[model samples]
Target chain A: MREIQVEYFAALREHAGCGRERLRTAARTPRELFAELSRRHGFPELGPLKVAVNDEFGDWEAPLADGDSVVFIPPVAGG
Target chain B: MKPFAFSAEPLQPASLRRSLADPRCGAFVSFEGWVRNHNDGREVRALEYEAYEQLGLKEGARIVQEAIERFGVDHAACVHRVGALALGDLAVWVGVSSAHRDAAFAACRYIIDEVKHRVPIWKKEHYADGDSGWVNCERCASHAQPPPARQAGR
Candidate 1:
C-alpha cells in the first residue's frame, strides 16, 4: 500500500525520538494514521497531537494521500 | 486566494510591504508587540519563549481567516519572533489593510486578540538572579493582559 511520510519537530520531535518517519497502512484519515503509526513506533505517550496536512491545520478526518506530509503538533506554551 | 500571512520572525514593515498589494486598500493598521521590562513586579531580565511551532502557525492562520470573515479586509498579516529576547525587543506584529479605515482597524484588533488567546505559544520569565518561571496562563486573563515578559533594566 502507498504510505505517507510523517515528520515531528520541536517538542514533538524530542518526544518522538526520531526526526522523520513514514507510515504504511490502510488507514485513510490523519487521526487513524497517526494512531497506527504511534503504535508501530511504540510511542504510547504520544498524546492527542494537532495534525497538520499539506501545510494546513485540520482534523483527523482529513483524508491522506501518498506523500502527504503529516506533522504532529503538541500543545506548547510560548509567548 | 488568502488575505493573510503568518510568520515567527521579527515583524518588519519594509519586508512585509509586498503583502499590501490591493490598490483598494487605503488604510493600513499595524501592531507592534515589544518585550517589556517587567511582569507582576518580577522585573523580568529576559524571556525564553517556546511554541508548538506547527500548531501556532495553524492557529494564527485560523485567526486571520476569522478576521477576514468577520471584517471585510483586503489583507492581514501576523508575524511573531521566536527564540530568546531581552527587554524592549520586538516580539510580535500584526497588520491589516482594507478599503476603509474602519474595517482595517477592527480586523487588526480582532486578529491580535484572537491570536493571543489561541496561539499555542508559551513564555518563561527570567530574573536577574538566575531564576526563571513560565508565565502561567491563569496569571493573566488574556494574551494582551499578560504583563510584558521583559522589563527595562539591566
Candidate 2:
C-alpha cells in the first residue's frame, strides 16, 4: 500500500473530524483515493473541487506516489 | 515587501498604504472586505479563515502581477487575514496605485476578484445559533455557476 498525506479544510475537515492524516491506501489515482475516503468518512460528493499534489494544483487523474501530500480544495469563499 | 501576502495578526491598512506610496502615481484605490454580521439570514457571530498557504501565496502574487500588467497600474498589494475573526473585522484588503484613476480602480477590482476566485482559501462562518457552514460549499453545491476551472479557458 502506498502512503499519502491528506489534508482536509472547511466542511471536509468537519466531516473527517480532523485537519490532516497519513494513510496507507491502494487507490491508484487521486480520484479513486478521494472516492474511497469519502465513502469511509461519509463526506458528501461535492464538485467544482480542485486537487493538489504536493501543494501544487494538479489533475485528478495524476498517479499517486508514496508520501505525496494531497489537498482537495472545495469551492473557495475568500473576498 | 512582497506585493501580496497574508497575516494571521491584525492587518494594518495604514502600513500597507504607506508601502504603496509612489509620488508618480496620481490615484490610489483600495478595497476592504469586512466580516459581516449576517449571511443568507443567519446571524454570523464570527468567522475562521484557513488557507493552503504555500499555494495561496503563489496564486495571490500571480493575481497581483496580472493586475499590474493588465491595468497598467504602477503597483498593487493585497493582504488577507487568517484565523478567528469577529464581526466587522478586516478580513481582506487590496490597494492599487496608478498614474490615473481608471487603472487604479480597475486593478484594485481585478486583484480582489481574482483573489476571491483563484486562491484556495476557505471561510467558515460560525453562527449565533451554534451552527456553522463553509461559505460557498454548501450554497454552491446546488447552485454553482460553473466551476472556475471550467470557465478559465474563456
Candidate 3:
C-alpha cells in the first residue's frame, strides 16, 4: 500500500466536501486512484480533466508513489 | 516580483503597469478582465477564483515569457485575482511594454488568452438566484476530446 496526499479544487472540492486528504490506498496509478476516490466521493464524470503529481502536470497512467501529492484538475475558467 | 502571480486583495493595475515601465519602450498595452453582472443569461452576483498555485504560477510565468519572446516585448506581467470578487472588480490584468505598439498590443493579448487556456485557475460564479457553479466546466465536458479508441484487441 502507498500513502498519498490528494487535493481537490472547485467542483471536485465541492463534491468531495473537503479540499485535502491523506490516506493509504492500493491503487497504483492516478487513473486507478481517481477511480477509487470517485466511488467513495461520487465525483463527477471525468471530462477534460488533468492530473498533477508533485505539483506538476502528470499523466493519468503514471505510477503513484508513497507520499506523492496529487491534484485532479477540473476544467479551468479564468479570465 | 515574479512575472505572473495571484492576488487575494483587489488588484492594483496602476502599479503593475508602472512595473513594466521602460524608457526604451515607447508603447504600453494592458488588458483587464472584470467581473460582470451577467453571463449566459444568468445574473452573476460575484465570482470566486481558485488556483493550483504551484502549477498555476509556473504555467502563468511561462506564458508571459513566451509573450515577451514571441513579440519581442521589453517587459510583461500578469496578475490574476483569487478569493471572492464582486461585480465590476478587476479579476485579471495583463500589461506589456515594447518598442512599438504592435508588439505591446499583441503580447498583451497573448498573455491573457494563454493564461485563460493554460493556467490551472478556476472561477465559480455566484448567481443572483442563490445558485452557483463552476464556470466553463459543463461546456468543457461536452467539448472534451473523446478518449482515444481502445486497441482493437487487448
- Candidate whose DockQ is highest: 3
Candidate closer to the true structure by lDDT (higher is better), 2 or 3: 3
lDDT of 1 by residue, A1-79 (tens): 5588887655445446888887677888776676676565544332234567766665667567888888655444433
Ranking of models by DockQ: 3, 2, 1
Selected candidate, larger TM-score, 1 vs 2? 2
Docking class of 2: acceptable
Q: How far out, in Å, is residue B41 in model 2? A: 2.0
Per-candidate TM-score against the hidden true structure: 0.60, 0.90, 0.92
Give the 10-residue window scoring lowest on summed lDDT in candidate 1 chain B. B145-154
DockQ class, candidate 3: acceptable
Q: Write the per-residue lDDT of candidate 2 for residues B30-96, one digit (tens) a residue.
A: 9999999999999999999998898899889999999999999998999999999999999999999
lDDT (Cα, tens digit) per residue for candidate 1, span B110-144: 98787766676656678877777656532222111
User: RMSD for each model, in Å, please?
Assistant: 9.8, 3.4, 3.7
Candidate 3: tens digits of C-alpha lDDT, residues B12-110: 888888898989999999999999999999999999999999989998999999999999999999999999999999999999989999999999999
Best by TM-score: 3
What residue pairs are clashing in model 2?
Answer: none
DockQ of each: 0.09, 0.41, 0.42
